[model samples]
Target: MPFLGLQRQLGIDLDSWLLRQSAAQPHGKAGACHAFEREWVECGHGLGQTRARRECQPEYEDFMECMHRTKLAARLKKILDQRDKMIKEGKYTPPDYQKSQEEPRP
Candidate 1:
């Protein structure tokens, strides 16, 4: 209630503030690995600690892999290298936007 006037002036309500805070967190709602995180959480939910640890190992591993982005980084690097090679060899054609920018508008 203390900051109600300021909140009104800024047009930011409690829900939006909470959303902003969560988005600032590492694994918040906008996280890229949400599907894997959900799988891990659902796998471990409502189970004993030991059972959850054992049963959810795969899900947890998948989630961790997604979070770390190791595979994604490697794949991205490979694609970039291939693109660079193509460009160097004159095999890569510039996009239409680039071509248009190089030429004068009719």
Candidate 2:
């Protein structure tokens, strides 16, 4: 496999749509979010292969949710494009459905 492809598969892609903004904000008053995500954020050699503080559950949950949303959006767009082409060519039609589907929200 190609090098760039592997980077993407590993979620190292910077092209992710969910660019979370955190200044001192990501670190809550209790600092749980920041502390939990330390292994990933401060990783140099073993990203996600290292153990994090036991309390960092929300950080991992947020990461996973973001990844899921990104993949869902990408797949939605691809399928929508295909469906539009089929509609134009009179290939597929659903009963009581509109002549076309709306654009997917980014």
Candidate 3:
């Protein structure tokens, strides 16, 4: 591998951003996604199309959706915290559009 190839190995795998199946994840419910991965691997390997087709489409999609939801919630929380800090400093006025969009949904 070339020096440039090492760039890909420099950090955690991008796939790890998805819900971790390991025991270290927070909350009892967090481990549920592990089942999806196991099913995906079994469906692919057992059918002998593991490399030729995506037998785990549903599992992959659901995992991604859950991952996105968690990431988005965290991002929103961070943004809100920043906004609060700015508000306290009297230096930032968040736009009405953002406020309206971010309002808690029912």
Pairs of residues at least 3 apart in sequence or in different chains that clash in candidate 1: none
Q: What's the TM for model 2? A: 0.33
lDDT of 2 by residue, 1-106 (tens): 1254786677664422222323334335433334434434443223334454344455666655454567678899999899889978999885666645787899
Residue pairs in collision within model 3: none
lDDT of each: 0.71, 0.53, 0.63
| Residue-pair clash count for candidate 1 | 0
* Clash statistics: count for each candidate: 0, 0, 0
Candidate with more favorable, higher TM-score: 2 or 3 = 2
Model 1 TM-score on a 0 to 1 scale: 0.42
Give the Cα error of residue 97 in candidate 1, in Å.
Answer: 4.1
TM-score of each: 0.42, 0.33, 0.32
Cα displacement (angstroms), candidate 1, residue 90, comes to 2.0
lDDT of 3 by residue, 22-103 (tens): 4456664546667776555455554555552566677667666665677678899999899999989999987887666666
Model 1 agreement with the true structure over 1-106: per-residue lDDT tens digits: 2254787788765533433222445544555766677677667767868999999999989987877888889999999899889989999976877654656589
